[model samples]
Target: MQTIRSINLQKNLGDVLRTADVETVLVTNRDQPRAVVMSAEEFIRLKTAAGEPVPNEVRKSSPTLHRRIADPLGYDTRDPGYVEQTASDALDGQHADEIAREIDKAMRRWRLR
Candidate 1:
């Protein structure tokens, strides 16, 4: 973001508008930020985003909406929570732990042979 004092903004309105299209611009009055200038695309994007409600978990995890911003992993939208719920229900947490221990014991016994 670039900071432009109110005096500079008025004096260089064309230059300031050009800069704002490339990136966000902060307008300040007496060294205090008073307003922001962003491109039309950015303004529309922010307006659309403001209309939607985000999940609490997602909000807490990423205040800047950084979730899935980098190296995003694709998910199958065709199958919703039901598929995941069914798969998770297939194995209880306790039973999975017990099975893991049993496998470790068997692997150790085999290694001793």
Candidate 2:
């Protein structure tokens, strides 16, 4: 593996990227490794070989929120009410009045009931 200081990374990023096939380049700051530089294809291949899910470009081409919604015992909805429920849960951590004001503004803009 090749090691380069953070300063060298800024100066010779192109050269390091070009030599990615020979070794994975490690970027260091304060003599401690901070990041790695490798070809995207190599990184994806390594991740897939390690049994991690590789993001599908076909799925990206045709995106849907249905893929993300959690199905607890197969009980989930495509309804706007379900979205509002999730939004409300997310906003629970914040000030209720502020969240309500923001929701009201969004509803007005979208002409939502």
Instruction: Please report how far candidate 1 places residue 58 from its true position, in Å.
Output: 29
Error of 2 at 1 (Å): 1.1
Backbone collision count in every prediction?
0, 0
In terms of lDDT, the best-performing candidate is: 2
Residue 86 error for model 2, in Å?
46
- Predictions in order: lDDT: 0.63, 0.66
lDDT of residue 71 for candidate 1: 17
lDDT per residue as tens, model 1, 2-100: 999998888888888999878999999999999998865566556557995434432232212234442122223222333475456445453455556
RMSD to true structure for each model, in Å:
13.9, 15.0
Q: Model 2 — which ten-residue stretch has the worst lDDT?
A: 72-81
Candidate 2 Cα misplacement greater than 4 A, ranges: 56-113
lDDT string for model 2 (8-57, tens) is: 88789888988785678999999999998876557666766899875665
CA deviation > 4 Å runs, candidate 1: 52-113
Candidate 1 residue-wise lDDT at 97: 56
